[model samples]
Target: MNSPDIKPPGAEPAVKTHDNRRRWWTLLAVSAAQLLVVLDGTIVNIALPSAQTALGMSDASRQWAITAYALALGGLLLIGGRVSSALGHRRTFIIGLVGFAASSALGGAAVNPGMLFGARALQGVFAAALAPAGLSLLTTTFTEPRERGRAFSVFAAVGAAGSALGLVAGGLLTEYTSWRWCLYINVPIALFAVGGTALVPADRPIRGGGRLDVAGALLSAAGFGAVVYAFNEAEPLGWGSPKVLALLVGGVLLLAAFAAVEVRAPSPLLPMRVLSHRARAGALVSITLMFVAMFGFYLFMSYYTQTVLGYSPVQAGLTLIINALAALLGSTLIAGRLHGRVPPAMLILPGLIAAAAGMLILTRLTPQTTDVLPLYLVPALVLTGLGLGCVLPPTAGLATSDVHPYDIGAASAAYNASQQLGAALGTALLNTIATSAAASHLASARHATPTGASVHGYTTALTVGFGILLAAACVTAPLILKQQRS
Candidate 1:
């Protein structure tokens, strides 16, 4: 029979004593680690062209660099989380940080496409290890509601700002320095984080009877990898293509099989109980849906600003800083302050509505609209950032709240994985929708120029994005409201 506390074999034992004074420093270390991971997600985008040119890679082959990172990191996230529980948080964190830094160094020094791709994938593996461990550390460290909210607010603000910061940093480095610096930049950050790890409380590894569910880990990782790869390929190859269809189908089948295995296994890579709570489940779903809008928005906005508005990479990056700043204020000042005082649903619902309205504002954009920055883009970006800021921090806290200590790592992994998969799905599905809309506009319109068709497609996609945000609100608002009432 399982004990109430269930110190399963892979679960780490609780620390005997915590250094209360050093907790804030620990948060800084974990936050820095998380910032590095999140920043890497978008930092490579601006540098991709330069990297490709340096490595002499074809356009078709170039995506492998990005895809490799996503697949490895996203797919292995659960395993990494589980491993964190098994190995202890500080150990996992340090190992992950070191490995990640080394991989970044390797990527920075790459002389060929293969070397860069390999290094990118390796970076992903270490990222998988780093993210959940950091989050779980934060979850375990800050248990008081007020302090937790404050902590998550800081973490969420950093996360919200990281992608935009990545754009600016990438642009600066690519233009003024070298693309290699983008990867090399991670090394110093990682080293600093490693040193910061010394302040963290030591965790004792859980040693007991349960064995690792190797099969469950394999199935889940492969399933997720295939799904991410399918979505990625869907952009280049039509959704109906055989390769895409097979991968999607196979991925689903593998995931289903993994579910069956988890039900019967003594120890699971992703314990079903971690997702059993209504709040946690709702949080995960909302996080996924939010990213669906966010990832698509970033991709299309980059295209619209650069292709239509004729912004330079640096200028394009600079414009996004508005969104980042807005997000920081909204998350840390607005949402963070209101966390315990207000019901989460109240904040999230209005935020979602505001975000939808913001996306709707984006629909007014066109090639004829010359004052794009002031008239349409800035307002929309600010609104979206505000909305997201309200949503992310609170929901992130909810994601791990009330979770079992044994399952904390898995819960964190699930949250991060949802964001990753959501981004991949958004990028693939929305891009496809927009491309098809453009093609149809070209074919059907009476006086359709390429520019007009493209803009029309972008607006059409933005409309869909608005609809998605509304749908997410519909799904999440009721769940949160119901929780509040109960």
Candidate 2:
């Protein structure tokens, strides 16, 4: 008879096969959750007009629907991450899914602006919890280096394509069906993920998980909330506005205080150890800067296609699908295949340069360039997508790699927060730049048509985006070098 500790002849392979299959299934569930989070950004953006019209929302009030989500998600991300560590990642993830589904249903049935805004805020609250938990799950599940690369690549591709896919989905749903379906759509997704949860391995939660630092949580939430609100206000109030400036400064101060609190607090929400690594810091910086440019890229592209090229909403949305598809290619064929063989800088440097080049090309768009799809948007989108593909997988790995098992959620949350802030700042900053440029062009060129002025403004902002991307590469280089040297 076999010893008590010994397995039967075929047991090991069978167990290995079972484990392998479970890992991929976990990835699928995680990816679906990620897509659900990301797609909401642009999907609701598309549905906003219809939502406003249906609910009889005023212009000023309409902005609140979007701002509520941004503020809640951005502010609560760190707290959410800590909660996951304390409660258990798997449990937090399912709770988030259930809450998100409930909120989506609430939004779908809303008959007033206040109700809609509250539901969207609820969605953001749950998403903040869900996003970090899912990421931690991925990191803990895939430990082998090469397989991690593959898993990250697949995950990054889904994230990279998510916004563009949102645009497409929003357009189709809003056009062909009711805007309510846009909110309704998430229910089925959440349910499917709930089912997929059965296959996910019950990973261990952080040790002594209940010792959360209350002060640190409060500080982080307020600081991040202030900063996000400041940026959101900047789009409407301008950077020089006293209210915006005050909020921005206050946010910075609160964040600094939070850092000090973390130094002394026994169970800090965001531990210093999570960011002590040079490579991880670099990764976070790179992703943040890329998003600062990328969101503006999407903003300008959508307007240029619709307002300038005269494409329908669906047509404008369709143009972005190419970018998503190209990102998929870049993630799978390039980064996934090459991650282990190369230093991250090898992929990262070239990716930034390529994306910058794409931004540069977009700076030359003319009102009459509508027919230049082959020579213009196609190449730009392809390059940007490929570059994003290269950057995301590598940076994602670096951001959370080699951290203490318990801090994984904190690290992942930090990365997500970087992305959220970057997007908020990008939209505000580039939009301000474009709006000012348009006013300047209109003043200088009496012959400029309104449409021409708008396009000119967009191109000018694209140039700023191009410069920002180059700056990002410069920032990455020395950080990577220092990490390498150490």
Candidate 3:
């Protein structure tokens, strides 16, 4: 990002310096927006304890802090895609940046849980716009294969490591200053992104774009929103509780209806063709599964380090840095370089396998494993980081690959929407699994200490995560390989 005049070595002779600068700036701005979304996912999590205490938030309301954002973003993403097409991607991106910054400011200045929740929801609304618009911008700008690969690598690496960076930032802010700074931090980042957007190439308008599909938008939003809220409520309410079941079933029906509407609509909220491509669909599924498993891993690591090891928030966050560093290596070094040459499955499948192996290593955890940093933690972090680093770039690229210019927004939205749903499901489902496992273990082994039971719960949940990762690999592997052969 620095020294705009200085190009990377081996700049193509055909490319002008001004063009190089614009493309790089575009990458920087889009990557920053992506980081904002991913970082916010976990940064606020670290600050939650402090925020809760200061706001007098009841334990009953804490989940809403997470749910409000996920629900809004997941539910509205499809509509956001349509909106991006209606309005220009560049315009939509700037609007999203301004709105997100304002919402972040409101969140920082919140006086009550209600205000905080509202602010979070507003942030999500803007993020739905920001994410798809940014990705589409990147896709349209970096048309060449090698340039696209490198640009995507940086973007993916930021996304892969952003959560850990959030942990680190949240810890430092919460410990050294007020927790409110965590939200306040977004203001400058957003403003910087907005400024950088000036260098971003404008999106050419889609010719003869059809009318907006109101029915599809409403159905998709309400459907996805309900599904996310259902999962969020599942841990406390019990999965089989009538409320959860009703919400889940209703959401599914609504989604089915949305799909049906898309089939007939003059202008669908998400064009069916966006997903009809087997590779793109598989990429979406893989992204969803990767996040579903990754978030749970993050949750347990944070808990185990802070609650069990009695580490400070900063120390806990610092422990995850290895994961981020390894991610950098894998993304830029391995996946980035090889991306243009190899099939996406080559990176994604092995990445999943490596992540599962890391989770398998963690299955050995016990409460008394006091010196886990050198033993259980580091290797697991490195493996998962490298794995995810390898996984994210290709999937992101695939999601937008071969997409029509008009449907790029839809494809991008689908990609990010998959990530949101995956994170929500992963956190809620895995936490529930961990809680239920701990309760069962305690009941079965009367002599087991609570700490031991907690560790057992974490390991059990991770074991499930391990299986999920492997299953995801299996599911997508054939899709990638078979399609390649055909």
Candidate 4:
């Protein structure tokens, strides 16, 4: 005789409701973590000069403050993604938030340069963990089509605005408080976010008890690290240096090995299945290209505002409000409307073209240029923002679209990894191009007038920025548009 059929009460249904509520809270917590991490990259830029004078850093060592974070974050992002999948998003997210906050505190309190740099690198490692986990949490939390689109729009907008907000926040904090506050600010934010994380649901691990692809992780990390190092070296060591050549070759070989290993591994770190769809591939490429152009624009435009136009950090930061506001509008309004109305590929093509046009307009800046009113620079800034806004949301949505639910973490990780690498490469390559152009311009002008040559050099750099933007547009056009008909 069967024991009375066990009803188990209504506990199962209750548990599911509780879990759903927790998942929504988790998305908020994760998004907060992501915003902090992304903002740190640019916030430091505004405070760099102040930090430099206070810390007595040399010109060459200055870039390391930024590069240290990028190198570690970009290099380890894929590993972080895979690790999150293997462990659990909830666990990884918590660990990352705690680690990131601790590092930020350390960096803020540093009395010496070495400590600060080390802290930044540590922050990068945790950021690598936090970013993908945050994204994957969103991907899993919102499974319905409309809810997914809304969720991604909010995520994308936060990400797009993060850099601009960093500039403004950095200026205020640096001027009123200290450069260290920029780092210290993360502590409280992270703490609050961590508390919120407790409310989010934890996802179960992929079946087969996911294994770490040690070889794949190493190969991918080392390869990206090598390539980034090569780009950084190119500016000081020359493009043809033996060390540069060695690094390029080593990076290529390691990446080739990573591809091979991914093909063979039963539980791959980044599976090929995530990239099988044409729309997804197009979206990833478009996102990469958008960052490529936008990062370079930021690098040059910041310099143009401060060094060339003689604006203080606060003034320059304020000017960027135009771009920031435009981006916010584009992400929220334009991006939301275009979601199902037009395919992502079509949206990306025009978005990139507009960004390229903005870059071209900026190339006209000169030493005597004082106002953005007559020169079309304000509109250019707005266009840049609009283009970025259009590209980021849809591209982000498409990148993780069509993947199996179990693979969301890995897919999100891959998307974030590509973005980080793209930004780093874009920064390094564009800086090198601008620096070389500046040197050439200065060399020619030195014979004519020594004092004026510095300004001439800056103009030359901005010109090169224009060319890079154009090239980015050309590269992305085919990739984005070719998939439209298919």
Across 38-82, the per-residue lDDT of candidate 4 in tens digits comes to 799899888888888888888889877777887788789888887
TM-score of every prediction relative to native: 0.94, 0.98, 0.95, 0.88
Q: Candidate 3, residues 321-364: lDDT per residue as tens digits?
A: 99999888899998999988998899999999998998999999
Model 2 accuracy (lDDT, Cα): 0.91
Per-residue lDDT tens digits of candidate 1, residues 378-413? 899999899888888888888888887788888899
Alpha-carbon runs more than 4 Å astray in model 4: 1-27, 52-62, 235-238, 368-370, 445-486
Between candidates 1 and 3, which one is better according to TM-score?
3
lDDT of each: 0.88, 0.91, 0.91, 0.78
For model 2, the stretches where C-alpha displacement exceeds 4 angstroms are 368-370
lDDT of 3 at 213: 87
Better of 1 and 3 by lDDT: 3
* Local accuracy of candidate 2 as per-residue lDDT tens digits, 1-486: 758999889999999999989998889988999998998888999999999999999988898888888999999999998888878888999999999999999999999999999999999999999999999888988998888989999999999999999999999999999899999999999989988989998976678755678899899989999999999999999999999999999999999999999998987899898887888988999999999999999999888888877898889999999899989988889999998898888888888888999989888887767556889899999999999999999888898888887788899899999999999999899999999999999899979989888989999999999999999999988897678677
Considering summed lDDT, which 10 consecutive residues are worst modelled in model 1?
10-19
Top candidate by TM-score: 2
Pairs clashing in candidate 4?
Answer: none
Pairs of colliding residues, candidate 2: none
Worst 10 residues of 3 by lDDT: 9-18
Off by over 4 Å in 1: 1-18
Select the stronger candidate by TM-score from 2 and 4: 2
